[model samples]
Target chain A: MTEELIIAGFGGQGVLSMGKILAYSGIMQDQEVSWMPSYGPEMRGGTANVTVIVSDERVSSPVLNEFDSAIILNQQSMDKFEEQVKPGGVLLYDPNGIINPPTRKDINIYTIEGSKLSREMGNTKTFNMIVFGAYLKIKPVVKLENVVLGLKKSLNERYHHLIPLNEDAIKMGQENVVSILEL
Target chain B: MAEVKLMKGNEAFAEAAIRVGADAYFGYPITPQSEVIEYLMTAQPHLTTGMVVLQAESEVAAINMVYGAAGAGKKVLTSSSSPGISLKLEGISYMAGAELPAVILNVVRGGPGLGTIQPSQADYFQAVKGGGHGDYKMLVLAPSSVQEMADFVEDAFDAAFKYRNPVMILSDGVIGQMMEKVIFKEQKDRWTEKELIEINGSWATTGKTPDRERNVITSLDLDSHKMELHNHKLQAKYKQMEEEEVRYEEFMCDDADYIMVAYGSSARIAQKTLNKARAKGIKVGLLRPITLFPYPTKVIHKYTERGVKGFLSVEMSAGQMVEDVRLAVNGKAKVEHFGRNGGIIPSPTEVLDALENQIIK
Candidate 1:
């Protein structure tokens, strides 16, 4: 099985790190993975995006024009990646700063109030883990145990104490995500 | 599995350098590849492996530092992007003329000037055709994945010392910035003083001794005849490399009608194109050249002789390696170039469309 995903948001939204964690989880499950980010000056505070591919076989390309799923955090990303999602794919987004929500009709659309949930959890930094957890819920390609292992691998040991909190955030996302359209 | 981890390509290369027992790393920060130096600094190889990691004031100074360390029989390395590499070219030429063994990395960006910081394979000519001023050819290895980014570090050092020539890992910004799973090889210990004497003592300016004369390292020769002889010697070593070190990978070529020749990140994209084309009943294949300097000329000729219809040379440049592909084909098959400049990477379907328009039609 292969899953090509794009996670996009404003800089410092943990877009790249979320993709990195997903890639590490793929490695934990003995799958091939690649994470390609749109980086440069635009990353100062502008929109940032990353393409992540996880596959049972060797991944052929890291850069792609289309994605099986899109996790959009900001309006800029939602507007940019809405049409890039393949038909019959998933488009998950947190309606935090989004002025223009996705209008695609051929793909499944899901919304999670990531910002609202993270604020309620008393940690705004857990926003990315919430979105990531919601994405995993939509498509359970990797196991939750593997996701925890991946978090351990990607996070520094000094921050290991926060893994349990991040896990709670992810679980929150999985439970609170609302499916808007299923075609 | 031996210590597999997901790492960015530039970081992987830096980690591999420390693991492969490189004596020193000297580099300046540049966009898309600054992580090479950043990772080295954070890892503190100087404290862990006793490897020196210095952020030079400039790319030129970094390369000269590489030359100095290499002349002393140290496994030295330096890395930069397109503009920075241009600054390092003179020092690179001097090292090549002096026959010093060093590893240089050019994580290329789109350029004629400062250009875009995004990924591009525009430095193919600069890399394989000797970007520096001299009659020299550095062994160039193009890595497509983070794994190879780590793996080629050991291979490049081996080739550099074997030929007493500079070796370059020609990676683009895509490979430099992208993250992938990499399995590192066993860590190696740096060369000892006695080992350095045994391995590179004949020419390296290690030290003057009572039994052995002081070794001199210089690229300058006032005598024209002597300079011509030096050029010939360098040419001979390049020829040896061509014969022995050409590396390439072929996919679905045995029964294909068309061939897409690419390297590095372009090759990775073309592999996806190959799959798409095959699914659509188009017989297309890919031949990815691993060593750019060696050029893989004979292999292209072999494919031509085997009745491949045409070749589509995909790069991230206006067209550089395409010229080499044409020369290798020798008019045996039609060769066309397709690319997007200014740091835009073409998609798989776009490449396949170019193949159909430029080659198949």
Candidate 2:
């Protein structure tokens, strides 16, 4: 199976890092993966997105127009990518800054209050992990254990102490994700 | 050491250079390829393998540095984006004329002059057709994946030294910035002083021994007849490389009626388009050229002889490689070009549509 995803948010919101973690997790599962980011001037405090692909077979193109999933963190991303999700695909978004939520009817739309929950927990940086957790809970493309291992690999040795906090955030995300559609 | 790690293509290229026992690297900072010099500077290969990594003031200085180190028979390299590479052309021509061995990488960006920082194959003509002034050629290697990005550094160094000429890794921003799994080869020992003398003593400026005359490294020939002889020698070397080193990969082409010719990232996208076309019952195939300089001309001619109905050259340029494809096919088959320039990468659907509209029709 192949899962092509786009994760977009502000530059400091860890959107690119989340995609990196997902790509690493796919590698941990011995699957083929590619993580491509929108680089250069577009990444400076602007809406940054990364295309992540995980497949059992070789991934053909790192660039894509349609996605199996789009994890959007801001309204600008939602406005931009909502229509690009394929029919029956998943559209997961954090509803904190988004004024106009996804209006697509063909895809499965879900909301995770990642920023709000992370703020409540007094660690706003855990927002991306929470969104990622919700994504795994909804799709379950990769196992949760591999994501933890992926985190260990992605984070530097000094940051290993914070893995549990990120794991807790992910678990919180899994529990609080609200499904808005059946299709 | 057989360690597989997830690495960005630019970083992996730097690590591979260190692991391959490269003697020196001189480069200027440029987007999409800056990580190569950054990683090298941070890793400090000089501390372990005695490799020198210097951030040159400009691309011009960097290429000249490469020329200097390579004149001493050392494995040296420099990398930059399109505009930076343009500045290095004069030095590149000098290196080619002097027959110095060096590896240069152009992690290409969209360009006429200072174009977008996004990926582009627009540098194909500049890379394969000799961007620098004079009748010269550099062995160009196009890598589609991160693994090839790492692997080609060693291959390029080997070929550069083998031919005593410059070699280029013509990658783009997509391949350079993308992250994927890469397996680094076991560390190779740098050439010892004894090995350098034994291997390159004949032509290298390794200090004069009492037994032989001093060696000079130069590209200048004041006499026109002497310059013609030098040109003939370079052309002969290029001919030998063409006969021996043409490398390409064919995907499902045995029974294909239509062939899509692309290299690097364009090739990767074409693979997906080929799948889509096949699903629609179109007999499409992909021919990816691994070596752009020794461009698989014979294989293209073979397809023409096999009665392939048409050929499509998919690239990120206006129509560079298409010219070469048309030249290779020689009007035997209908050859066309499909592209998205200025860093706009063509989507798979667009490529498929181009195939249907331009070739299949």
Candidate 3:
């Protein structure tokens, strides 16, 4: 099985790290993974996006025009990537600052209050983990135990103490996601 | 089992230098590749392995430092992006003339002059042809994945020493920045002073021995006749590399009607195009050249002789490597070029479209 995903947001919104964590999880499950990011000056403050591929076989293209899923965090990313999702694929977003929601009719659409929920959880840094957990809820490509292992691998040793908090944030995302449309 | 981890191509290349027991690294920071030096600095190979990592004031200084270390028989390397690499071309030519064994990495960015910092394969001609000057050629290795980024370091060093010629790992920003799972080879021990004397002592300026004449290293021979002979010797060495070290991968080409030739990240995109074409019942294949200098001309000629309808050369430049492809085909089949420039990566669908319009039509 191969899952091609695009996670997009403003710079510093953890879009790249979200993709990184998912890629690490894929590796922990003995899967092949590739993470390609939109790098350079635009990533300093403007929109940022990452294309991640997790596959049972070797990945073919690290740069792609379509995705199996798109997890959008802000309005700019949603506007840019809403139509890039493949037909019958999933579109997940955080409905915090989105002015226009996805209006597609051929795919599944889910929303989670990632920004609000992250604020409530008192740690905005776990925002990406929460959204990641929501993705796993809809598509359980990897195991939760493996995600913890992946977290350990991706995070520096000094940040290992916060794994439990991130785990809780992920569980909250899984529980709080609202499926608005499923076709 | 070896160690496996997710790593960026630049970082993987740096870590492999240490693991391969390279003696020194001298480089100037450049976008899309600064992580190479940053990783080495943070890893502190100097403390652990007695390896040296220094940040030079400029690209010119870094390449010259590489020349100095290599002339003394040290396993040395330096890395830079397109612009910085341009600054080092003179030094690179000097090393090629001097028959120095060192590795230079060009994590290429879009070119001409201080172009964008995004990935581009426009350096194909600069790398495989004579980038600096004269009839000199650096053995060029193009790696498509992060794994190959780490894996090719040893092979590069091996070929460098075996030929006593400088080798170039011609990567681009895409491979340098992307992260993927990599399995590293076991750590190798650095050569001792005695080993260096034993292995490279004959020609390398290890030190003048009392029992023998003092060794002299120089690339300058003002006599035209002597320089002509030296040029002939360099051409012979390059020919030997072409015969023995030509490396490439052929995919799904046994019954293919059309073939696509690409290298580095362009090859990865072409693989997706191959899959898409097969899904549509088109017999398409891909030939990925791992060694850009050797050019893989014979394998491409083989495919051309097999009556393939057309050849598509996909790249990230307007058209550079396509010239090499056309020469290889030698007018035996239809040859076409497809690409995007100025830091844009061509999509697989667009490449397939180019194939249909330019070749199949």
**lDDT (C-alpha) at residue A179 in model 1:** 98
Q: Candidate 3 chain A, which ten residues in sequence have the lowest lDDT sum?
A: A38-47
lDDT of 2 by residue, B27-140 (tens): 999987999999999999899999999999899999999999999989899999999999999999999999999999999999899998999999999999999999999999
lDDT of each residue in B141-193, candidate 3, tens digit only:
99999999998999999999999999999999999999999989888888999
Runs with alpha carbons beyond 4 Å of true place in candidate 3:
none
Cα lDDT computed for each candidate against the true fold: 0.93, 0.94, 0.93
What TM-score applies to chain A of candidate 2? Answer: 0.97
Better-scoring candidate (TM-score), 1 or 2 = 2
lDDT of 3 by residue, A109-167 (tens): 99988888999999898899899989999989889998999999999999999999999
Ordering by DockQ: 3, 1, 2
Please report how far candidate 3 places residue B171 from its true position, in Å: 0.6
Q: Could you give candidate 1's per-residue lDDT for residues A72-164 as a string of tens digits?
A: 988877777899999999999988788888887999999999999999999999999998889989999899999999999999999999999
Instruction: For all candidates in order, state the fraction of native interface contacts they contain.
Output: 0.87, 0.82, 0.87
Better of 1 and 3 by DockQ: 3
